[model samples]
Target: MTRALVVAAHGSHYNPGTALPAWRCVDHIRQTGLFDEVTAAFWKEQPSFSTVLDGLRSNQVIVVPLFSSEGYFSQSVLPAELQPRVGQAIRITSVVGSSAFFTAVVADRIQKALVKANFPPAETAVALVGHGTVRHLDSRQTTESQAGLLRGKFAEVHTAYLDDEPYVADLVRTVTCPNLVVVPFFVAEGLHTQDDIPDALGLSDPLYESQVIQNHRVLYTPPVGLEDNLYTVVLALANEYSDSEAAADPGLSSELYWTSHQLAQFGQVSLHADALCHVDDDVNAPDLEILDTPEAIRAKLRFTDSGEFRPLPTRRDLPHGWKIPAPGDVSRWAALQMIYPGVWKVERTCSPHEVGARQQGKYRPVRDISRKKVDSLVQSVCLHCVRHPSWHDQNLESVPGCIEPCSVWLEEAIKP
Candidate 1:
């Protein structure tokens, strides 16, 4: 029998949001019976790239990155990891949730979101926010390309990023519209979703109050996450493999399985050990700002393994021991959108025209790319959702694959 494995992705550094979508995708695919097995892995955290290949039950593993664009992780990191398994009876194909074809899907979601907020194509400044990286130009390029497409399809669209040039604030300043709308082009509401973006715009946490920028002329919308539209995105990908013939390789499967198991086991052991001791007070604690830096977090943790963390502490809970907050607890991960409505058009009832009519005097529309291909598999996905809407719930929670953030250890009482 041929078995297929589909892996999902998010950027990681012990952040649940970074790894949650990947795990959720794997579980969703498996429940639909579209693949024999599906396993989720990450660029950071547990089930490292080195270990993911070890746990494959099928000779064919289809790795799908959940990221919206081609960047370092997709271009450099993913390719290097898969190179070793090239001809070893294991084949890997890269598929992702959102890609070039997703612009239309996002455009649909954006228009709906704007309409509900009483935003118009004329005075409304549509800001496309992305997590741009200085390390790779592709991050900004992807965001820029997507914005250009949106401008083509709709009027008054502007592009911005959390990093690099043409910063978000600068881009938003260039829009001539009296009112502005910011849409985060991210997969989930994580650190950037919860903290960085809002901080950049001078908005408060639990950002519900719609305040005007430079005196009520500009408005910011809550982020887009967990919308029913995402369900549509997921369905599109699963349908791609529903009819493909499965190719099996027992030897390859065993190797992948053992490697993953060992890596998971090692991670657990290291966590246990790290949990045992308090941070040495003698060392200067890293500033709260540095926790966002992965290398800084790694250096401060004082891992005994010389590279990673040690085992978890067996004690009930040490006064000096570090306890990382659950991803769900991060103020950054909290439901900031719930406090604010109209982030997604799903629950709101407002006509697109009625919302934008107020600002309908001056603006520009951007061209959008339409590249969606519907196949027989898409029908299969529609059927799956019809039969089992609850399928995603099973994987919606955080997975065991993520490594805890270094913040937990920072909270401990340091000893000299």
Candidate 2:
């Protein structure tokens, strides 16, 4: 039976760095060739939780949440979104943060800090900072549990939070150790580790590896999620789940229904002269980059034409003057996936009503806004994006419409 692994993560809509760790983990897992297929599903990014499994070809699939804790997203959101189809067997594993391998990773991170500072563990304190919330006790509990495991190993092991009591700011001010190591327990580095935590700790430099604050030498490490060995944690969780679960039906293949013939033109890309080329490229355009592989195309799309980072790949700012030589249908299809990750599956399956339903379920904040406000937001945000609104009919001859509102649209609609 063919098996698949999906790394489900809470990817940021505005910050591209938030999704890098999960993608890196997926890349490593893919290299091992442990499963028939490996992909990533994100709550706030493309190939979202609602549609990630729709095109899988595996009979048995394992989804491992890339969250750092068993909080709101891991417990509630993931289960609600990842519903399996008939004859398809799906197993959702415990969040990666709960894995025993993760505890070792945390311990290793702290050890590295101690060794670099030449500070004895008995003289230094360690702070495990987590993004805790009052809505769920699991986050705090998991963090404290990890800290508990290391309590006797160090002079003091404390748990701090961004939301709950014993907050990050308080921990920085109250901790008495002359040498403290602050390790962010986040799944990835983002606004929290890069800005909030550093600011709260009164560190002069946000990217400082070590700094003295209030006469106390403090060492700040990168978030644990960014560790190169995170794929091991994912592997451990998948192995544990597979061992306990029963065999599943060898379901029908869920390969993408659309063909390259159906993809003649996308937002700013088109098939021309047996190659997938940018709409603006011509003989006059200089510095044209030749992308020979789908991976190369994906890497190129990480930034805009003007050299700015593009957090949302669906934006209208896809760079020009680059082309993928797609002499065959397979190459064309692969190029499309790199240019528009999950659009083909969405275009093939989603109807107007289904699109509306997806939008209603995913963008709950849209309900609170007035119709006029919603229209204005859509005009400003959706119109400029590469995706056509759901109102447009899906035709292979034309650019495909979006199946639902994107995260950027939802974020703008919910703005106070």
Candidate 3:
């Protein structure tokens, strides 16, 4: 009867904006009396998934990922972190929150943005650009899924990506539409949304462009984060967990609630320690100083259960213009290296903590069992999961991209 709620998000040390919507989702759910307990976890940041379960006060819990599409973190990281046990008889339900409804929402937002700009939606070529991968076809599937629903709702719809086959550049060759409007299917307005996509479209700034990309007469909408309609996504997820179908066992719900509370306590403690590095004047901070030392990194992994993003400490005395506050992680590490090479050294690592048995667990032997179970459980959950695991775990290795840096540092060569 113990029911708990874990809303997982792909956290970034490099973008506060990425985690913002996930947090908003958790807040909306808590406002409703849906579960005996509710908590949020992240792939990065504190409240690490390693120890998220210790906080569960409900006998049953529903986990919803606040991602725009099914990608690696939703599949591999989330399942591994919430690794299920056979005999525990824990009634855990996982719902993939990336829905076709989101596509309609995005389309609606685009129509409105264009209307405000005095452009007709029927005349504009809506290009939904996503970050696609070559490994798993699901990233492309997700974009296609979005596009399919969008095409049904709108007159003109097209799709593109940053990587893999049928790329953004191909739009110039493939798309037959005349008046193009690009809408990035991304959660934030980061480098790719700002610098890379715009550059590819051949516009200095579509906001001020007198000429358009490919001489196709284009219009670029602001990244989706700036749109206000996203709140609907969060509200709908909370309703899913709180509705009448959820169990009414007070005892079970109470236990899960208490468990979630305890996990939250432990999570907050580790979160504080993890944030400590933010204030440390250590020049090696970007190199993941926490992961460099065994004990230092172990401190953050102490959570027996409970996971989610919490505030980290940053240099309080940093002067304005000295350094822009950057989210700290590997993808950002790579982006920064690509953008400002001299500012930092990029070192690739292979020994991910979540890798095989040895690096994954707190102890070597237990780690082995956990790793084995992790493999088996992932396959099992994917087969019976509410949504396709391929949709979430878009990467081939079934692991997060950022953590691969440190994990690789320990085992393999660091390549971009």
Tens-place lDDT digits, model 1, residues 1-416: 44555454544443434544554554455456555555655544434443455444454555666676567666765665543344334443333423555566567656675676666676566787887888777777767777877785445787778887668766655777776777777766567877787778777644634566554344555444333355335545544544464433333433332221222122122121112113322112342222332222333342333334321211112122222221222221111111110011111121212222322122101011111211222233322211111122222222222111111111121111
Top candidate, metric TM-score: 2
Provide the clashing-pair count of each candidate structure: 33, 0, 47
| lDDT leader | 2
Q: lDDT of model 3 at residue 371?
A: 41
TM-score for every candidate vs. truth?
0.55, 0.84, 0.57
* C-alpha local distance difference test of each model: 0.45, 0.75, 0.47
C-alpha RMSD in Å of predicted model 2 compared with the true structure: 4.1
Give the range of the ten consecutive residues with the poorest summed lDDT in model 1.
336-345
Q: Which scores greater on lDDT, model 1 or model 3?
A: 3
Q: Report how far off residue 222 is in candidate 2 (Å).
A: 1.0
> Residue 226's C-alpha lDDT in candidate 2?
80
Worst 10 residues of 3 by lDDT: 313-322
Extract clashing residue pairs from model 2.
Answer: none
Q: Candidate 2 residues 188-287, lDDT tens each?
A: 8789989998888777764556788877789998898887788899978987877433333334222334565655567778776467777777623456
Query: Which whole-number lDDT from 0 to 100 does residue 91 have in model 1?
Result: 42
Error of 2 at 224 (Å): 0.4
